[model samples]
Target: MADIDAIVDDLDAERADLEQVVAGLDATLWRAPTPAQGLTIADQIAHLNWTDELVMRAIRNPEAFADEFEGVLAPAHAVESISAGSAIVNAGTVERSKVPQSQLLTMWRRSAAELSGILRALPSGTRIPWFAPRPLSAAAMAASRVMETWAHGQDVFDALALTRPPTGRLVHVVRLGVRSRDFAYQLRGLEPPQEEFRVELRAPDGGTWNWGPADAPGKVEGSALHFALIATQRLHRDDSDLVARGEGPEEWLRIAQAYAGPVGRGRERQRPLDAV
Candidate 1:
């Protein structure tokens, strides 16, 4: 498990970065289409707000979360299937969009703060239920929340053509990305490679961060930003400068997912950074 304090700090930093991105947008920019299909900048924020609330609710009251989750899934009965669950969850996002942008921003900020507080106070070994069949530890859940914020923040930044530079805060996301290799394989119903895999990333501050065993047969090396983007499914392997070695590392790099969700059809190879 990671240091919960460090993870919470990074979460705060990521949320602050996202807030900065949306700070000055007018109504038109708020309504502008983001990279996500048919989702606007406002919709992105709404989705975040809704998800933040959902996670908080899950942590505070499992029974309430179950009811709310089932209500969100009322349109579909197969919540066990990833796609069905995703659609149901998306319905909540769409429902959230009915709120005015100003109100949504306020709700997002409040929920984020409440989320941070809950995560900060949780016992290290606590397991919280989420979209995945298995619950996650406090540290893992916090890290996933940060990854979601960063991934969705990219959509907002890309929609506005704003350039968000990589920072040391990305270490949390990179770590989650590396650790999720097996989960990614499981999500796709493929056998996880039986070999150890190594990941080496160049942090924005010129420090090198490494994960997995040093002498592993599989390896991935690249800019931390690129790894994070690929892990979030915002960039394809071909679009990144990452060097992959061994079949395990290469395939893992191609379909990495740091966030818990159904397997996604990742971006096409050679997709431009701006297009992400």
Candidate 2:
């Protein structure tokens, strides 16, 4: 079984890394546009804060979370579409963006801390309600938070033209990416391959992280950082260093998504700095 406490600790570290980046930024920098269209660096943090609060509510009171989820889905129920749900989610970020950056940061820090506390105290095997197809265990939820913080932090870093060094905590994201392979295909209305694909990634500490059988017909190999970026839709596949050795693995790499939601509009291909 996964270690819930350790995952929550990594989630805390991920939040701290992002907090350090944004905490140093002035108001002007906070308003800078990110790769996510129409969303500023402030919006990124606001979105995180908003989601963290919602997740906290889900953990603390599942019934209330269900009511809110129903309200969010009500408008889209007629058409059976998630666009309305998406808009409702986006609206939270837009509304939260009105707060002063300093205040927003304070709110985010409080929410994040409270969330970690709640998760740490949560009983083992307890499932937390989510907007997902099913409830998630405390450990999965915490790991998702880690992936999200890292992904959104990437946008903030890109907006400020800064680079963050890879950390051991990224293993959570890599694991999520691998586990979501089938979901990624299913979400796109494509049938997932039956056979598992071998995944071999070079970790930040010069260790190889392996998943699946070594003799699997399909394989994906690359830097863990690049794989995480691709999975999170932070980096375009064209710009990544990953290699896919078979058709199934290749297709999966092209549309990998480690996040829960409708399909994401991933980053566009960029010219290399040297080429530019």
lDDT of 1 by residue, 76-95 (tens): 32224445557767898988
TM-score of each: 0.90, 0.93
Q: Write the per-residue lDDT of candidate 2 for residues 23-83, one digit (tens) a residue.
A: 9888899999999889999999999999998888888888887777774434323223344
The numbered model that scores best in lDDT is: 2
Predicted structure 2, TM vs. truth: 0.93
The whole-model lDDT of each prediction reads: 0.83, 0.88
TM-score of 1: 0.90
**RMSD after CA superposition, every candidate:** 3.8, 2.8
Any runs in candidate 2 off by more than 4 Å, and if so which? Answer: 71-84, 272-276
* Candidate 2, residue 246: how far the Cα is off, in Å: 0.7
